[model samples]
Target: MLLEAHSLSFSYGNTPALSDLTVSLPNGATGLLGPNGAGKTTFVRIIMGLLRIPKGKLRVHGREVATESKALKAVIGLVPEGEILVPDITAVQYTAYAGRISGLSSTEAMDRAHMVLHYVGLGGDRYRKIDGYSKGMRQRLKLAQALVHDPKLLILDEPTDGMDPKARDEMLDLLKELGNDHGKDLLLCTHLLDDVRRVCRRVLVLSQGRKMGLVDIEMQGKDTDLYAVTMRGPIPPFIDFLESHGFKVDVDTDGEGQIALSRGAADQFIQHAVSQSVQIRRLVPLRESLEEVFTRLVSKDT
Candidate 1:
């Protein structure tokens, strides 16, 4: 397991932050999704060894976090949501310093800093002071710093937060490469459903500091029994025919759509449509979007 928590709970004074959260996340790209105040940040902080394990067992990389935090820090990298860069330093200096903090020697830190800076497309601006860099450049620098240590698992908080369209796409592509080609495990914490859908294979959703759902992106909406069907002509007779034939049909208020039947029913449905003089305009499997899944999960929690 990449992360394992058993009865994990935390609080900030009188208010609760995490409530009996238990989950085991495997090695791969996973998205951490939630609305505001869902304890996502608090969970990341615990993984980074910044917060003490207040109530229950929490382990990372199969080591107890409460006792092995110092050693664990070397194996985990973080791209925090807020800016933590030193404005006066050059990008190389900043990245090298981060590598050194992760326990690398001076020579290795400098070398890796240069390599990762180039990897993140910041080679040209590496010598420039960070204060002069734009928001996108700064975000890239943060990613470079996180990669400097070459940690096994990267915990990123809003990596594309302020980026424009082009920059956002570039950053997402980098994330995909790191996960697919470079063999790095990632925990992407963000509010953007599209980002999760694009890069992550699995998602862990939280609501009000509790686990709401864990979903596999590839298996989310591949319901072989359900399909979206559209047709032209008398909708009432077609719907009646389907209902009478024991097909479950959910029609829209507009009376122009239906979702029903299994793969075996496809031929029969088409034949019936033709017999009823209804044009089979469109028929396909219903694949639910990530946005729809997120909304459903959060709303259920409420």
Candidate 2:
């Protein structure tokens, strides 16, 4: 019951950015997931009071957004998609300045700066110039500034966008820790399905500025994937045996190949192959990727 939006709708000229969007987010991380131009940014802007939604109701912590925007901002921390740090400034200096702007004293700001930076996994480089920092380090700096004020809610837009795989994983892990260990409410806006699966428990999906889907991430992730599996055991016959039963299989002599189909098909194929005296060290479902799911959802919505 931390944040709620009822019948939230907005448009620019003849095109709509959000259509009758409605959702209630709890205390944990709630993922606002969709592809580009899906109105995810518009949704965050409305909640952050950056853009006014002429229609519908938006509230934070039982306070009306229109009437208490200042109070609302005091309790909300935003990490935008782009870089927010001063390139020439060190992480400590920028974070301390942000803390002071959030209404902390000089001493308190410095303390909070170190604290948030440490929590964000930049303890050693808290004084490093942001211009020379890695993508991961810069991401951590953005998050550190958002936490300096101790806002009740944190809204992040593509926090790990420019990172390599390892950096992306690190940023995600830090975000998870922020929500769980720090007792903060999170509004995570991203197109990465792995982010949703790894961090947020609840999810809202947007498409073409219309509220297309709202469901728990758990439900979306529950066995709807098929993996390309490999095995080191007696897996040589798995592919041929599966094809003979109309399972549509592709093989690899090294016992590594793909079996693409429905979730039911994957499970049945694995079970049947195992029963046929073929030992499979791995029975992976070529799980549908997040981008693929988003594409399918948008296509179907239209």
Candidate 3:
């Protein structure tokens, strides 16, 4: 398991932040999803060892969080939502500083800083002061600093926040490469569902400081029985036939000559369509979008 929390709970004075949360997250890329005040930041802070474990057991990579936080921090990197840069320093200097904080020797830190800055596409501008960089460049620089230590897992908070569309796509592509090709585990915390859909295989949703759902993004809306079908020629009779036979059919509302049906009745549906001289143009299984899944989970929690 990448992370395991058993009966985890936390509070800020009289108010609760996390409420008896229990979850096991596997290795690989996973999205952390939640609405405002949902404890997402609190959870990340706890994992980063900034907050003490107030109650229950929490472990990262099989080590107890309460006892092994220092050791765990050595293997975890963070790309926080807020800026961590010093305006007077160059990107290389800041990145090297981060590496040193992660326990690397000065020589190793400087070398790794140069390598990671290049890897994140900041090599050309690495010597320039951070105050002159654009939002996108700053975001990438944060990523460079996080990668300076080569941590096994990266906890990214709104990594693409404030980026334009092109920059957002580039950042997402980098995340995909790191997770798929570079063998890095990631915890991508963000408000954008599309980001999670694009880069993460799994999602853990929270609501009101509680675990709402854990979803397999690829399998969330797949129903073997449900299929989208398009047909040419007259559609009313085919629709009538399927509806009369007790197979629920939903005609496409956009005038696309498409309908949805249960796959169990597909043979009968197709046979009737053939008998009626209707052409089956397309038939494919339907998958739910991450937005739909997120809405459903949050709604249920409320």
Best by lDDT: 1
The global C-alpha lDDT for each of the candidates, from Candidate 1 onward, is 0.90, 0.80, 0.89
TM-scores, all candidates, are 0.88, 0.74, 0.87
For residues 100-189, what per-residue lDDT tens digits would candidate 3 score against the true structure? 999999999999999999999999999999999998999999999899999999999999998999989989999999999988999999
Ranking by lDDT: 1, 3, 2
Question: What TM-score does prediction 1 earn?
Answer: 0.88
**lDDT: the better of candidates 1 and 2:** 1
Question: Model 3 clash tally?
Answer: 0
Q: After superposition, how far is residue 151 of candidate 1 from its true place, in Å?
A: 0.8
Candidate 2, residues 7-43, lDDT tens digits: the string is 9889988889998878777668888887688899988
For residues 172-264, what per-residue lDDT tens digits would candidate 1 score against the true structure? Answer: 999999999988899999999899989999999999889999989988876657776767788887788889998888865344555677767
Stretches of model 3 off by over 4 angstroms after superposition: 231-246, 251-279
Candidate 1, overall lDDT?
0.90
lDDT for residue 195 in candidate 1, whole number 0-100: 94
